[model samples]
Target: MKHEFHWSQYLDTNHQKFLSDFKEFLSIPSISTLPEHKEDIRRAAHWLSNKLSTCGLENVEILETDGHPVVYADWVHANNAPTVLLYGHYDVQPVDPIDTWDTPPFEPALKNGYIYARGANDMKGNVLLLIHACESYLETTGKLPVNVKFLIEGEEELMSPSLPKWLEENRGRLTCDFIANADAGQTDKRFPTIVTAVKGALGVTIDVITGPSDLHSGLAGGIVHNALHIMSELISSFHDKDTKISITGFYDDVLEPTKEERELCAQVPFNHDENIKRMFGVRDLIHEDNYTPAEVTWFRPNLAVHGLWGGFQGSGFKTIIPCEAHAKLSIRLVANQDPSDIFDKLERHIHEHIPTGVKVTVSEFGVGAKAYTLSESHPALRAADEALKSEMKAAPVHVRMGAAIPILATFKAILGVDVVTMGFGNGGNIHAPNEHQNLAMCYLGARTYARFFELLGTDGPVDH
Candidate 1:
């Protein structure tokens, strides 16, 4: 506690400079999905590596991935202490629909106690906080209570394609007892939160072809099957009248929420109709009759068709039967479900339902991760609760999020460790335009992470 309080003093002395440095970090426009921003992504990685080295962490380096580079650093002087892997991402989602932003997405601006910029809250903000927390400890006491390592990757928005191989290759170097992910968000601005579970993701592409080329509808209407129609029919087959997934074996591995989990889920606040209007701008949500809206999103899997393309649209009617059609699907998986098995079942179902005149192909992409859940009694979570309560003066809430953090599962499968997903960012507007983070939460987060490092390193839980 003495060293932690000393670390807080370091944070206090450098508070303004930390804010200024973070704004500069947010201005790089490290959009991973865009090819033109490759340099920007590399710049962000270099910037992070430099900060880690300057922060007095040992072995700070930028390691190359097939795509973007990963920034690695650590302090392992605390022999026999638990090693905590701090995980985060520097890459941000593309700022599409550019006109929607109030300010330039890459130009960080401070207004009304918030920083408005791309990657400001989604992850980069927390990344900075974690780094500063480490810096605080090293600057004050010249060491940490626990061994700490940072694995800040640049391809998280792209589902972290290079991480699995990287993790396997560097398992010994990156070994840790548990991970602390700063990529999560709080339940509300007034209350901190710890994510107990995260749904996994599987991405697939569907392609259909009815002929070699397009043909005039007048000539092809009765003779040939339309690829668009075939694709539409195929998409329809994925769901039934009750909106449940129609694919066989889709729910075979799903773990039913325990009674305790159900109770915790029930305590999470909700206003179904208000959520539909505020978050989705929709009149209704589709689901089975037996479950609450929260259960449907958090405890169950849901599939969505992100894009559908086939015919022409050039402000004029082009009467042609398109020869090709395609759709991109993203499926969310809950605990105990395997992405590979679901993809295999889906591919088989698509092949079985192909029309007579059309051919269909299904391709699975990326090394997907399985869903994960941590026990309520996990020590890291208990440490997180204590840290959050100390920082916010309020107990944190526990919830399972619908979104997937692929690396959480990777840390578990490869390192045999659970991840404590403690959050300081807000939930809304992460990937959207005008994305921002509350500066006040940033301060609280720095204090908590600093305290958490101490708690994890101690022989037993540190008294609050």
Candidate 2:
């Protein structure tokens, strides 16, 4: 099979150009969830289409979906070579509460060796790293080692609603041997890591209505069923004193963490006290008898109340009893757990705890996705391990993310391919304010991707 020649020289020569291109890409505010920025999202897709075309990818086009357009590009160089599909999102989350930002979110300021922007860490940085890797091969050798495809979507933040439909419609063109997603976070700043598995998520909204309208608390508080109390009671049942989720049958499908996996988790350097203090401003860790905080996050199921709304909250305390209360709850599911089954059990559990005279309504906002794990023995995994070890000068660790990436399941189900989730960027204030990506990781990530492709090109399995 043909492979790219002199790829490293090209990367070294065009390093400055690559950084400039990334800055320009980050300048576009492709926030997909907001309707006002629809054109901006399309503009980002067009920009990526042009970049892919410049990198020598064939069949490049912006295919419009129900929501945002998907940029599809591929090169069918050799029929015998393995086809790798690359997936990432150009769209970013809405930079709300914009006043809190020290520097403008969309301005793309480089301060303290870090890029300060809304999508800097969450995705755009990683996207550019992958693009540069492809560019390196093309600039040096004129062709790729393997047939490659790029599927950069614009609706990942909004639950990726259009992705499934788009994938179904264009199933024929998306056939590939394996997928690689450069959209996840690294294990830490000191060590290079590959996230082989991602946990799933399920969201539900529960509402309780007790009376027709607000009533006088002094008179009705004693006799009437309180909607707030009922909602609280139902929410409280989803957890125990150990903080482990209590939804019936929630763990029935959960695949226990293997001994090797647990050992891998133990290898990750963690300071629970510092982590808690840095994250939640807490003094000590909480919950569970046998498990540590890291284990709870990576190996177990968790239920969290995302949002709760009910009574008044203006200036002073209101004496009136509210007629209704609502709460938005979400569950993070682990490996082997079925999201649909978990949602059903949660609904049933809520109904069993409903208080009389208060009508409880349960609406599932979204269902969770199952976690994913790649075989450690796979050749691609080994290649990834070698690439990271060479680049970082330390053996990379294998880790699992607590967060869910729904596309993992979609890729596995639709294309029948396991993805190599390797990227740089640590989880620090990811979705929250002050989100930032490490500047050093940016270079390391690019090097890793370049080396990964080089390794795969030279020694990757030829059977597939």
Candidate 1, residue 254: how far the Cα is off, in Å: 1.4
lDDT against the true structure, per candidate, is 0.85, 0.78
Query: Model 1's lDDT to the true fold?
Result: 0.85
**In model 2, which residue pairs have backbone atoms overlapping below 3 Å?**
201-368, 202-368
**All candidates' TM-scores?**
0.92, 0.91
Model 1 poorest 10 in a row by lDDT: 455-464
> What does candidate 1's lDDT look like per residue over 1-464, in tens digits?
32545888888778797898889899998998899999999999999988998878989899987888999999988877788889999999988889999999988888898889999888988999999998898887888888889999999998899988888989899877788899887646455778888989998999999989999999889788888988899899999999899999899988777788778777765424465356655777777667777888778998899889998868978999999999999899998888989999999999988977678889876767788888777877877888888878887788888899987888888888888898688535888888888887888888899888877777543221
Model 2 TM-score, all chains together: 0.91
Best by TM-score: 1
Score residue 143 of candidate 2 by CA lDDT.
73
| Best of the candidates, lDDT | 1
Cα miss at 462, model 1 (Å)? 12
Which pairs clash inside model 1? none
Runs of candidate 1 with Cα error greater than 4 angstroms are 1-5, 270-283, 459-464
